[model samples]
Target chain A: MKKIFLILTISLVFVFLSGFNEVVASATSNFSISIVSETPVETTVIFRGKAQSRSYVTLLKDAQIVAVTQADPNANFEISLTGLSAGIYSFGLWADDTAGRRTSTYFFNISITEGVTTIISGIFLSPTIAIDQAEVRQGDILNILGQSAPSAQVSVFINSGEEIVKTTGADNDGAWLYKFDTTSVDLGDYSTRVRASKESEISDFSPTASFKVSKKSVKSKKKCPAKGDLNNDCKVNLFDFSIAAYWWKKSLPKKIKKRVDRKLYRDGKINLRDFSVMAYYWTG
Target chain B: MRISDLKFKLVFSFLFCILFFVFFSGNILAAHLYFKVPENLVGVGQIIPVNVFLDTGGEDINALEIGVDYSRDLLKLKDWSDGNSVVNLWMERPGSDADKLIFSGLIPGGYNGKRGLLVTLNFETLKEGRAGVSLLDSSEMLLSDGAGTPAKLSINDFWFYVKEGASKLESDKKKDSDSPEDFKPEIDRDDSVFDGKYFLIFATQDKDSGVDYYEVKEGEGGFERAESPYLIRNQRKKQEIEVRAVDKDGNERASLISFVPVYPFWNGGIIIAVIMILLLISSGVYIFKKKN
Candidate 1:
């Protein structure tokens, strides 16, 4: 009986000591993982230190392993996951040693989306976008309107055989119009495509529109000015010289011609050639 | 009154209403100035010719005035408003004439208070990277009909970005000038190891404030804080200074080591030759000493 009690006591004490050691070992062996998202895009998580032993890592989303990688003991390791959607997501990590001993769990939150929140919904379809003009001269404002869903994002795509213009968001109720400074666009037929997307989705392309442009610049022949063609009278004789002399002395009848001569010839020489053109015109 | 007279009056009134509807509806359905060229991403030193278009409801406007508000540190102004179309030639800083701008213009022949006109501005870049160009407030004014007093119009301003790089036009021309066979993309591996190359650091939470000076580390080929804050550069392509935080005591924190690989021109042939020479000299000396 005495031997039995002594043996039982020793066994109980030994078991308690072993249990305490095991608890300590398990606490030290455990590890926790977490994820942190600092930007709009969910970046891949990176690990800096090496695992203590050869192990395999498993990335878990809601306790489900979405990705896995093997790592060497005492060797640096890294694995990347394409970030989550445009909302908060919890992620955890666990590493299993060769013997299948697992690590403690970790967690982190991520938000992946642009900060600009746009409200969309009200959209009115129009029969056709009314351009301010059916035909416009170069540098003329090509006003456009028809009907738009109020507060929609409207942009005009000017098809000048190339992308000639792009625009910012327009106020539909106030200024939902796009202007084409025809100076940038060559004289030709153009089909301007208006696109209004509701939620920044690429699939949204507005119905196309077409318009014609007329060149305002006078399509005149490039003629050289003869010296005595005072009124550009087309002759180099005394008559031309008389006109030039008059303009040179004081002022001429046509303001544009006077200004041109004053600009081109400041000294007002008014030589024989001017007189010859003026004389020829005067005679005719 | 006779029936014929009453009928005639009704007909006239109906025609008047129809005409009124046509004119009023036309007036309401007008277009206005929406935006400009270089919607975004303009290059530094590159001339950006912006064409301004107006959306006047079949009317004309005369005389438009434009203004600018920008940072001289980042952008430089050249010339503007050539009297035809509004033109602003901008250059980026650190090179020459780099600056930001606000542009506006006027048109003739429309209701002065509501009509819009287009102004085309050509800008030149001064540097590389991103910056903002906006239309300043109270920068646009329109004239009234009969060319009288001009009324202040509500101008919708815009912000566009600029990215200055080697001129694409020049680059394309260069490509045409140089045959493809003459163009070599190989990296030269014969340069010195330490070619007096320095580092550039950038830290900006937002693009508006721009980047200030970078924190640096000390050494020949190690990290360092940038001497000039505010003027930051992206050094991802080169050997850059790894930044570490400083405490109140001016001591560095035990930070993670950063490693970047850079292969500059030079160092290849010299490294191999130096190794070969050392080996040969060592062997010759060994043979001589043994024989003695």
Candidate 2:
């Protein structure tokens, strides 16, 4: 009886040990695959997941193997695919342990678009260009103002010329201003437009703004005539007397009196004294 | 013997649990970048707007390169815009050659959000057919974590159908008939310096179709394209100014204001001469009285 009891205890111990080893082996052999990419992939996609260490990862599209890679030290695996055509694609990811003790297969459906790869949408509008003045004198400053895409670089083309005269960047509010010196521009009508660019995109040219550059007007500075040249025609005649008679008794402002001869009229009135002075040097 | 066996089993069970946990919990979600276009039937000759955006999935990205492929025969690249992009600097300006569009830019501090637009592309349909826009594999997004690590991105392409004789075009034409609301313009005058010139400032707003341009006329001068704050030639004379605000659809609203400029009494040359003569006469009379 003592010997039989001893044998039964040993048998129970051996069975328990074998059961624990089986449980461990089964547990370590378990692996799984999870796709980390968003659905409806265009031309490229990335698959990432976890698998047993030193495991082989195979990616199959429509039952054909496309890629094979190995999991990292931490049992993390990733697969990337590119240049896929447009159609319904069935992707299957299978992870096989190095010892061939475990394997996992994950299936997913991806629909690729035909023809175009990406469709981008947003607010897009043609820019507008406005000038400060429609006409400017030679040697004056011409200010170009306009609105375009925010944070975009704007180039101003003068006379729609091949050369870009000025370049400026638009502010956050999409407003931009550029000042061009008209001293170098010839005296004639010229058209100017602007276009905005950012990254690889260039916007359409803005509407042209036409402006004229006129020749600078010259003012002749000549001394006040001997007396009656009120019109500054370089002659003291009846015409000058008529101008003096028109203001016979009126009170004149200081600015106007300064322009007139102070010698004839020291006081602030136009009377016979001024007329007499005008008559003295009259040349009608 | 039993104690040793129990100890070995405990250690083995712990190791198995650790391996299971590591293998099952190692997945990290990545960001997504894709295109968005109208899915409805677009009409031939219609302008279609497409948007490229980034769904960061809570990652901060600083730089990106996007390449798009399309059918050039069915669609003509009209224009593109970066109006709503978060990137401030362009490493490569967005452009298209034939059927491919490419763009590259960088955001200063990085962007972390959902559905951030990168660019907008406008295309005109050339014929009735289906066209696909897809992302090329060369596209890349760099994380903002100083290492410039490439972010894992899953891209999605889009397909659009163009049809002949679509009703959307008729609706767009009908919208043009709705005239822009009439708005009164405010007038301002600038006469600080007496250079014998002043400016008449007029400003108004058009809610619909935006103000195309402005036309202004002084007196009998023909209506000319003039911006607000028009320069008047004569400061001391009355100016009959008429301003019209024209909308994009060619509808116009006009406003007229008469400006009568007044100069100070000191500005008159004739008035100053008269005052001087009167003063001289009074002085002469006083002198004659004293002499008598």
Candidate 3:
């Protein structure tokens, strides 16, 4: 009986050791991309681009909507703004996918002169993604979902100890899904992101999703407010913006670490991406 | 050399001069920079209203730096206005130095439109002569691309006459009688600025005469002249604060915030930080004494 008791105590200690329960630092999404293209042309300027299929794309001048167009089934679009006076113009493109989700606004500062058709090409909208489960048990399926340019190739990248990548295609509605099996994934932390590519153009990565490979699954909770709602008030406003502003450009120190949601962004420091995410989910 | 050859050379030289001036001169006004005043003639004892404007010749620009040169003997800068200016953020507001007024600013998203109002200057006329006002040749407009590229531009110098017998000040009938636009002031506390003290930051614009200055009032204290990012004297943060933006025309716009809560006494973070600093200093002194 004495020998059995000592054995049981040793077994309990071994099972509870720190090495067997390693923790992976959760990731926060970071993505703010700005691209500029110049077209040397006369009065008439042509903008050609690809967006989510059947999505509405609008042109903005100095934050004011000037024109709008709907993408074709092939995700191709062209907007010709005529009767334009000769001068400088700050032009931008904003999109709404079939599901009515808005993409990040892309701006182009261009100079217009008189003469030929100046075609500004290669505008590919970035993809928006989300995950169904916050955490999954080993050997279970994690479903990733999002919308992209219609029929475009979608690449999902899962990063554990080793990076696993797979490709799928968006349907005509611009919706794509990838079911990821976590059986082979080590029992550690994981981050996954996606990107979309068309004929010759590829977009930047989507918001990074973070989860853990644990013994039990945790369904994504909608009760929680959107990212950047630091006060748990279910609203993102100037109060939350100020909290992030205090950490601007500072490499988050361990003492003040993880005060923000991991899904907000984890660039080496707080930057425009963190602000962009706040703007994306702003309640006011 | 033959007489025929001399004639040919003279004719060629004349034609070349004409062509050069015509072609380049046509392009000279691509980005028109000029000054607009109430009139060319201003009385010696009156104020001269100077408004600077820029037409970007169709190029989108995001940054600008301008320095003005004027005759110190003829004009003295009485005041300046940033009202309704194209610049969204000013690195340096118009600062007067000797005979020059310099300013630098940025338009975050960028601006690409004609006749963008850059700034307004009110000069007190001193002498009766031509007040030749012009921008320094070093001034520049950078393209809006992520990369700061120089945009092609043409600089135009302006001259206005100040006559001795000129009549009353045109500004007496100033059109910018309207008050400044509404704005909100923010309240914040930061460890970096003012050593964790609370402060207020605020701004606004006047479409006509422009904003001249700001005033801040704390609790019941009399209003005092202040600038943005002002340090709060009441660190306890238990006071009502009001900020007012006064335009060049003396029109004022005020925003008020209710009482702000005092910093909590239970903030153990502050106590621990003070203790950590004290411990480090004591430890250093002890090591030095032991070494000695």
| TM-score top scorer | 3
Per-residue lDDT of candidate 3, residues A1-284 (tens digit): 55446545654554444233322211211222223333544346678888787888877643335579998987778898754543344556767777655555565455555444556777786676677788899999999887888788999999987889999998877899999988877887898888888776787666567888889899965423347565456554454555565565566765334645353555445554455455444432
- The parts of candidate 1 lying over 4 Å away from their true place are A1-284, B1-35, B81-118, B127-130, B147-152, B164-292
Write one digit per residue (lDDT tens) for candidate 1, span A191-234. 66554444432212333455667764322222223232443533
Put down candidate 1 lDDT per residue, B1-292, tens digits, no spaces: 9996676567656655655455354345433444555446655666654444555443333333445454444455444322112111111111123233443222211222222223334456566545444556544433323222333344455555566553353322111111010000111111111122222222111111111223554333455453322121333333323454332223332223233435443544567888889999999999999999
Second chain of candidate 1: TM-score? Answer: 0.33
Interface RMSD list for the candidates: 37.9, 37.1, 24.8
Candidates 1 onward: DockQ, in order: 0.01, 0.01, 0.02
Worst 10 residues of 2 chain A by lDDT: A116-125
Model 1 chain B poorest ten-residue lDDT run: B177-186
lDDT of 2 at A60: 55
Give candidate 2 misplaced runs (Cα > 4 Å): A1-284, B1-27, B169-292
Task: Give the higher-TM-score candidate: 2 or 3.
Answer: 3
TM-score of chain A of each: 0.29, 0.34, 0.57
Residue A105 local lDDT, model 3: 56
